[model samples]
Target: MSPETTDLPLTLSADHYHRPAPEIPGAIALIEDAQVGVNLAMLQTGALQIAIDSQAVKPGDKLLVFIDEQLVLVSLVERPCNGEPIVRNIPAKCVPDGIISLSYRVNVEQSAPLKVLVKTELPGGVDPKPEAPGHFLLTPPQLTPTTLDGGQAETVRIAPYPGMRHNDVVMLKCGNWTLPHNVTAHEVGQPLTFTLSPEMVASNGDGAIVLYYTISDAVGNRATDHSLGLAVMIQTGSATPVAPTVSGVDQQNALYLSQLGSQTVTVSLDTRAFTAGDRFTLVWSGVDRTGGIKLFTQEQILERQTTLEFSVANNTIQELAGGSARLFFTRTDAKGGEQQLPSREILIVGNTRRVSATEASPQQAPGEFAAGGS
Candidate 1:
């Protein structure tokens, strides 16, 4: 007849004591070094077994397994005249997602937990690309000495992408720099955010840089997809801008919109280092005829040209009858490198009167058009 058997739980209890770790002895030992890839088909079939010490684990004793510190499996050990371990068929869904750990214990806590490496939840055909972000202007404080010393950080907002799960690890890479963020329970399926220090930006300030992000699920499965990229350039330091040449104004550098009629004020730049497909934006800012805040803007895309010309509408020119206004333009090169010119003060000596008339002839006086207070 078979000898009577004992019972115990893996957790600490009044009757249980710590035991040496279970041995995955013999051919079944391959389970100990399973830190490789997830065999989805095999896990679903429940063909795996837990090799145990026939002497240490008694009949009726409880066996337990955990992943990432979370309990996931529990089984009862039965006995007979056999050296084979109890084939514990753990369902695939029962395995908790984890990065680097999987452990088991019998009756009482084991001397140590086994290291298990399993990769699962790989994005076979799902989209892995993160949403692109709009361009951002770096504020003065962002480039201050505090930022350089790591005392300050620049915050970035990330729009939520499809299939985001809690505990997934997300990473952002720009040029030679990268940062990571862990997904929290409440942050799941919501817009995520991360930060980049000023030092990081300054290190990548050489030229236009492509930015992107990647995601790794909690199960150590890296998304099998390439992320979309956006190009941007960080600007710091200082550079003098060539004064903007304006046509359709009196000899006093004063604009008279009433006399100008339907004619527009043409602002031209001597395209320096300009190329086709380059984009230019012209902005006019100052007080309107009523002395209230006013702003006007225009955009132009260069095809193949020597000069960058941006025309100001007659109504826009007439609206700025507050004596003077500020005019400035920014150029974004084909490769995404951007250059901003300092604001140039222009005289607007015209009343709010709009009418149709002949166009004003071109006028140029490089020295007279010198940039003033911005």
Candidate 2:
């Protein structure tokens, strides 16, 4: 039989035990299935994985790799030198030292480049900090007055400048008036519209009012720009009476009522100069055949332009002693005082003969002659 086999002594067989490799210096080794790029190299060994600069080794060279200060691999350099980085374009908006997905289309003449590294370098002596808005105004303020009544409130809207933020405040500086309003809605780089209602407006020694404004940020940094002036004229007291007249009648002193088979005679009352609650009356006075006084009157409240209609019936016309009458218009204001317009004479006529002789010649009342004969 072969020589009897026996177990070796532990001290004599020490060379066969497993142990960690010594530390390696000056070079790093590639791992199995390693990937090399233009500027980077990835290595994996044992339980450790790491990346290193691939340009450290020339092609066809061997290198020793260290893992945790121990020599774990010895790999040969098979990757070729990388071509110079060719970046066609950098990202449009890049903040210094901020991580950004660089945008670029690169082309290399040599073997395909491996990794990409983007560096955003600031110019020397330049800072990359954000800044507050600078003073800017596209155009001056254009103010439009809503009303000129001092007893009523007035509204003014201002178009804001570009680069305005919602945190900005608008300050209105009219005579003896200072209004502070905040911007509720505004986006960066966009214009804003601000509206304000002032309780009272100042009169410029006269009856005219003016307004202006300034703009400021939340921190109180204001724009030193000036705005155009807004002017308004406040009307006080009451409007003067423009005098009431009969519609379609040119002459102020005369009126004619023709017989349309006792149809209603309608005349437009111009009450434009009057307001609500004013009172007025139209008076018709004449003499009856028996020497009795014949008088007709209608009262009205002024609302707007009004229409007044009355009947000049045959019975009413026949009662006049001379078939003649006089009509007058009167208006009363806040006080009971009255304002009477010029009087108009009436001439009565029948189908065949003249019931009353014309007191005023036809030339004196041309509008009356045309109206009565029609």
Candidate 3:
């Protein structure tokens, strides 16, 4: 029952533990109230310390901690202290990028997979969830073209905290971008400002941007408090758009299969922020009642392409007839983020067109009616 054993507040998740290493993957079975959680403040300098309930597994079992699905850390269980509890430290690079999912294993198979929604890497001596991270009060929370002075730089005020001192680093994160600054001797215990350049603000794109700053004191302590965040919006024409524009057919347009032999539905998005290699998917829905084929879909761009000409085949159109179909396109960024526009619906007229029939009875030699009455 050492003080460090408190780092793991929860039990190892799976009651089952496999032999070790590769054998543990297929041996995990989530059972009962068993669980594992993160103690941010307890995170050591270079490794993750986990506590396992002595009653959960026997001594000498191996423990594995996976970060972001990669087996980055491993440790062997130490003997329990009179059934008090056991703490095992897995020495691996601890990174909380995006969303962090950490799981534990004993021996080969038993597992208690734990997913903690922590997005910051906190070093020693700081509360993982600090009451006040940095004095990050944005000068003007909202930004438009006029107020922003055509993408003029915006300033965020970061006041010194109780432990603020020189050599401490302050890092500001806006949307996906970050800006860093050093705390000067004169700035200690005084208000500091981080400037967001026009390009920096624009890089965050449109819509609400989460603004928060982390502090790494001279003593090497870091923490980010995400409970409340500064919400900033920049509505420039070139910023990342809120959603893509699905063009070609609108609700007012009723397509006739006879006329539109091959249909092309164009999707327009802000190419100003388009990143190559990102995937754009055209989701065509609302045609479940159509005949022949119930679903319709197409793919890709504009010059960003204005005349993208992503054509739909006649057979697809035939299947999509007899009902109104809606289309929306989504952009999947390289980081696996997605943004899509509202769906556009088009009414389809008539059933799927079929090949015309030709009657081929021998024609009476240039003349008479074939009917008996004649």
lDDT to native, each model:
0.50, 0.36, 0.45
Superposed by TM-score, candidate 2 places the C-alpha of residue 336 at a distance from the truth, in angstroms, of: 32
| Deviation from truth (RMSD, Å), model 1 | 25.4
**Model 1 shows how many backbone clashes?**
2
Model 2, CA-based lDDT: 0.36
Candidate 2: which stretches are off by over 4 Å? 1-143, 186-199, 202-206, 238-374
lDDT per residue as tens, model 1, 1-374: 12222353334443443543333222112332343334322343332233444455666766665444445556556554165554443344555444334455665555344454444444222432211111111101111222122235666566665556676676665444657788888997677766777688665433333344556655444543323334344445443334567786544345655567888888887765677788889876654433345678889988777888888777777666633455667889877889765334444554432221232322321111111111
What is the descending lDDT order?
1, 3, 2
Q: List, residue by residue over 1-374, the lDDT tens digit for candidate 2.
A: 11111233212123532222221121123311222111101111111122334433355543333222222333344555374211111111211121211111001101111122212221111112111111124243355553344554555656655446555566654433456667765444444444333344423111323344555543233343323334434443354223223332223221223423544444345665566777878766653322245777778777655544434444555555222344556778878877664344333322212112122221211111111111
Query: Alpha-carbon error at 225 in model 3, in Å?
Result: 3.2
Provide the lDDT at 33 for model 3: 26
Q: Deviation in angstroms for 331 in model 2?
A: 37
For model 3, residues 290-353, the per-residue Cα lDDT tens digits are 1122555665632343333344555655665544444556677778898754333454544432
Off by over 4 Å in 1: 1-125, 128-154, 235-374
What is the lDDT, from 0 to 100, of the residue 318 in candidate 2?
53
Regions of candidate 3 where Cα sits further than 4 Å from its true position? 1-150, 224-227, 238-374
How much is the lDDT of residue 332 in candidate 1?
90
Clash count of each predicted structure: 2, 3, 15
Rank candidates by TM-score, best first: 1, 3, 2
Candidate achieving higher lDDT, 2 or 3: 3
